[model samples]
Target: MRRRTPRVRPAALAFATLFGLADAAAQTSYQSMGRLFTTPSERMMLERQRSDNRAAAAAPATPAGPALPPVPEAAPAPPPAPQRVGGFVRRSDGRATVWVDDEARETTLPRVAPGAPLPVDLGGRNVIIKPGQSYDPSNGTIQDPR
Candidate 1:
């Protein structure tokens, strides 16, 4: 009696088909006009799409991830007002000219401390001088305290 060869199992054949050589075109999606595609332009377009799909399928896969949030900006600042500074400077004279912020004192005394406050009567009103500041008597300037 002659020995019989064993037939290929259905499961084995199915697995071979499932994991076998894959056609690059099958991996990509493209429009198909089926048997209706007839014109030269349509045929050329279909042929071009086939080539594009083949190239795309051959390329490696890229990783997908979530997007990041945008950052916020700050507002602009304001400019500063003008400032006046400095105290009195006495020269060789009988009356010491005491100057405040900008005004030079008319009533010259014999001696006084460099930054010490001086009392002056402006129209029967007394005014005290401060350091690094001056009083403009001509302009009737009123300086704010720091």
Candidate 2:
């Protein structure tokens, strides 16, 4: 028995070639070409910008006004001294006295509250200090113990 091979028809070969070329063209990218070319509107905009830059460069620069005197740089200020005060509590003649700035200031120990303000004199200046708080005589800053 003799074996006969299947033959490809001319119409089938042409159809295959056409479809293959069509698929290849559909898959091909055109981004590089797009970057190389610009639309008419874009070209006009570019030309307008170039003309504006050229006009600005050709125009005469305005004369500068009289130069102002250079400002002198100020020296850095020194750090402020620490504002702190030390006090000691003393009981004399059955009266509570707070010694601040080496002066005795009397206060009612029974009337002083933990959070309430207690009036006291520091260096002849009246200042308020809470029972559980610290007082700064230099700046009159109150610091809560809590």
lDDT (Cα, tens digit) per residue for candidate 1, span 1-146: 99999999999998788765444355443344345777899999999999999999999967576655666666655433323434555668665555443666566654667656656544344666555543455555647556
Q: Candidates' TM-scores?
A: 0.26, 0.26
- Point out where model 1 deviates above 4 Å: 1-86, 133-145
Give the residue spans of candidate 2 off by over 4 A.
Answer: 1-94, 99-115
lDDT of 2: 0.63
Worst 10 residues of 2 by lDDT: 79-88
lDDT of 1: 0.60
> RMSD in angstroms, all models?
26.7, 19.7
lDDT of 2 at 42: 84
C-alpha RMSD (angstroms) for model 1: 26.7
- Model 2 over residues 10-128: C-alpha lDDT tens digits? 99999999999987776675533456435888888899999999999999988599877999999988644322234435355546766544446566454554455556654466666
